[model samples]
Target chain A: MKKILVAAFMVLLGASWANAAGTAAGTQIQNSLTLDYEVGGINQTDINADDGNGFLVDNKNDVLVTTADVASVKVTPGSTAQVLTFTVKNEGNKVQDFILSVSDAGAAFSLTDNFNATSQSIFVESGTTPGYQSGEDTETYIDELAADGEKTVYVVASIPASQVNGDASIITLTAQVATGGTASSQGSATVNDTGADAEDTEQIVWADSAGETDAVEDGKHSDASAYEVQSASLTVTKGSCVIWDPANEGTNPKRIPGAVVRYTIQVANAAGAQDATSVVATDVLPGTVTYGVGGSGLTQIARVVTEVCSCTSPGTANTGNVSESTGTVTATYESPISASETQCAYFDVTIN
Target chain B: MKKGFLSILLIFAFSSIVYADVSIKSQSLQEKIINKQTKWVKATKVIPGTKIRYINTMSNNGTVMAQNLVITNAIPKHMLYVDKSAKCDGVCSITYSVDGKAFDVPAKLFVTENGKKRVAKALEYKAIRWIVQTLDANQSSSVQFDATLE
Candidate 1:
């Protein structure tokens, strides 16, 4: 019986030891397993924050993002069009939120973006977008996007295509997020005559930028001659093998490429007459390109100078009767943004 | 015969296109904008032992050329006593002046076609040759002279 008692004591001790050891082992396993702090070089996993949408930006000094885009806009030339696009995400860890805005101070103040439709589009200058600036645009808010949130704002700009004569502006897109928001990344878009190829009857009115130059040629194109004044237009394209000769001297019609290149053109005056009003010269340079200097006299080749006059003022700078022969009336033009190679610029000389 | 017909068709198509195409005309003034020299003249300042030069610039604001006309200038008498020059052929003429004074100046100036001058003072001398020339409408000539002042 005593031996039985001894065995019982040993069994109890063994049971206790086993329980203690098993508990220790379970605790060790729990400590050994942990949540990984990093994935794909992103440390956000460490914080394990909300807002499943999170991004890691390599460049923290300059980060310009288009938080929102105005899909619809109404534009008219010689007027102000302000579109709202915000730079949302600032990626730095700093608490203070930098202001986001745009301006055309660095770029030419005259050439602002024209949305063309009634819903005018705003032009942005440097800050986060093309029209580089640091100040807040009108109606711009959100000094600091919350660490995980974004700032929303709009861009407002004034561009008068007519009075300004080649008016344009740019949209500078920028973002000021919490951590090292921008590293050196800013975005920009060029402003142009939005109504360049409008099909509306009023389209010709906007083309008034031609002034009085085109008026006389339109009348002369009515007459018939050996080389009937066929349709005429000024156009441009990259240099071609047959025509791109810089050495060929003077306004080679083949249309050389430039932010502003000169284009000159002539057509057979088949039914050329003083009354012909279709003769036209139009300049079609890429809207992306701009003149290096003001009044550079570099314009589209297809543009015809127009002369408009009231009873008071002398005919506009280029206006004349069909019979009149102006030095370069209706012949010179500066190019605007062109759509395609065919639309590059062409005049249809209709034989009456 | 087939090849000939094809060639004729191609030519017709090309001619039609060319007829309607507005193009650069070789006769256009914009096309003639080559780096062509328009005119030149001598300096007005005369000095010895200095590099002499005529700073002549190309026409209109360095953008376009000025055309046609004539002008006359006389070498200062103080510099060229009785220099051999040319008579005005309705184009150019030159004069002389020993000193840059009104009375001592020559009554008439001579013209230099291929202007040539010799410095009486020194081989290294500068003479500001006073010059005059007429430019046709829309034409220009910018002539300047660099020399040490006497």
Candidate 2:
């Protein structure tokens, strides 16, 4: 009987040891990497979070460390041309760099207001330094992007208020690293305010305005940055643009949600000037366009008729749902715009 | 009688199996290929006066996103342009479009600081430079130029 008891005790001890070992491991396997997104007080529109734990969203923007992060863009037409805005926060390990660009996809869009397609280059980044130039133009940066940095750019597109129907456009933007750079932080979202309200279009005829245009992008340099302005901050003040008119809109305009309808875009300074010297009217097709007749105040830098926004702004996509073919986008500007001032754009599209 | 019953059961099983082969359903998510791009090689545009400067754009198809993207070009000559590149200095670079516009910039030419033909890398096409972006889903990006064309 004593020998039997001893054997039973030994068995019990062995079982207990096995149970303890399993408890130490808990549920998930040990020594494995897992990613989680962070939460709390995070803005769904603009939030910083790593997946929970070490998955860190840099500034904690709830964004994953992976390169597939994306952001949304919003373009609203105020009294001037239109107000295009978006916010970006650092959501990665290393310092981040951002670039925003756009292109005309095709006839997937139409203008709500009549605009000029002449004498313009939409300054799309942020119209100035400390801010991304917000117009339809070009600028480079040399500064190092610290991890989790955040910034926003606003573009003020100008059009001569003479543009009509059948004008389509697309825009693309890129965000990346300022250092060894990869398209990792590459994210994209689109905004549109094109075309007129049904009643407004039918009521007003020939109340046209010229369309505007612009571009954006980001990259890295091993040596010193070859750009003039690496980092930018935009400061905005009140300057009324020419009012938008629903009348005289395009004869046939594409229908897109949130498209930029009639807008009055204006800027004090567009170029690198502190006093706000360079400002031009620009247009972007919500999609494809067909009827195109070049204008003087605008330059047809791109006559893309494909379904996607053909302009190569950095991101995961060119034009999301834009039908890249069959339409036109126009841009215009103001040197003085007071009868005495003269402006000339490159040319217009004669859709093939 | 028992043997006959076993034969009938066997036959029924065989027939069912044959029917399954004839009526199996297939599941697949198929999207039509729009613009398809083939192979593409890019060189850093660095040469100052080369009239024919290279521009970086999407490969082959104007709209289709590239799949199984590959880089057949060599280093420096076949790499993205990077200043102080540890691998290929002066030879590595990239290009970008202004507002997505397809404009021709200046040409790029790679020259070793030591003034020696880089036989070590065996880069292709005079060994300028290039890079490959592993795009996801419908992702896209751009390459910047170093030199303008003639």
Docking category of candidate 1:
incorrect
| Candidate 2 vs. true structure, TM-score | 0.19
When summed lDDT is taken over every stretch of 10 residues in candidate 1 chain A, the lowest stretch is A25-34
lDDT of 1 by residue, A1-352 (tens): 0010000000111111112101110010000000111112222111111111111111112123442433322333444444545544432212224444343222112234432222332333334544423353333334433333344455554444442222233344333222223443332211122342221111111111111112221110010001011122323332211122233323443333421332223222222112223334433433343323123233222222232112111222332122113222233322321222121121111011
Q: A1-352, model 2: which lDDT tens digit per residue?
A: 0010000000111111111101110011001111111112121121111111111001111111111113212221222444334344433333334444333221112322222222223232433454433343343321233434444433334433332112212232233333324443433221121233221111111111112221221121010000011111222221111111223224333233211122222223233322212333344543432323322122223221212121212123212111223333233333332212222232223222
Query: Once superposed on the true structure, which residue ranges of model 2 sit more than 4 Å away at CA?
Result: A1-81, A106-143, A165-170, A180-352, B1-150
DockQ of 1: 0.00
How high is the TM-score of chain A in each model? Answer: 0.24, 0.23
Q: Which run of 10 residues does model 2 chain A get worst, by summed lDDT?
A: A1-10
Chain B only: TM-score of model 1: 0.26
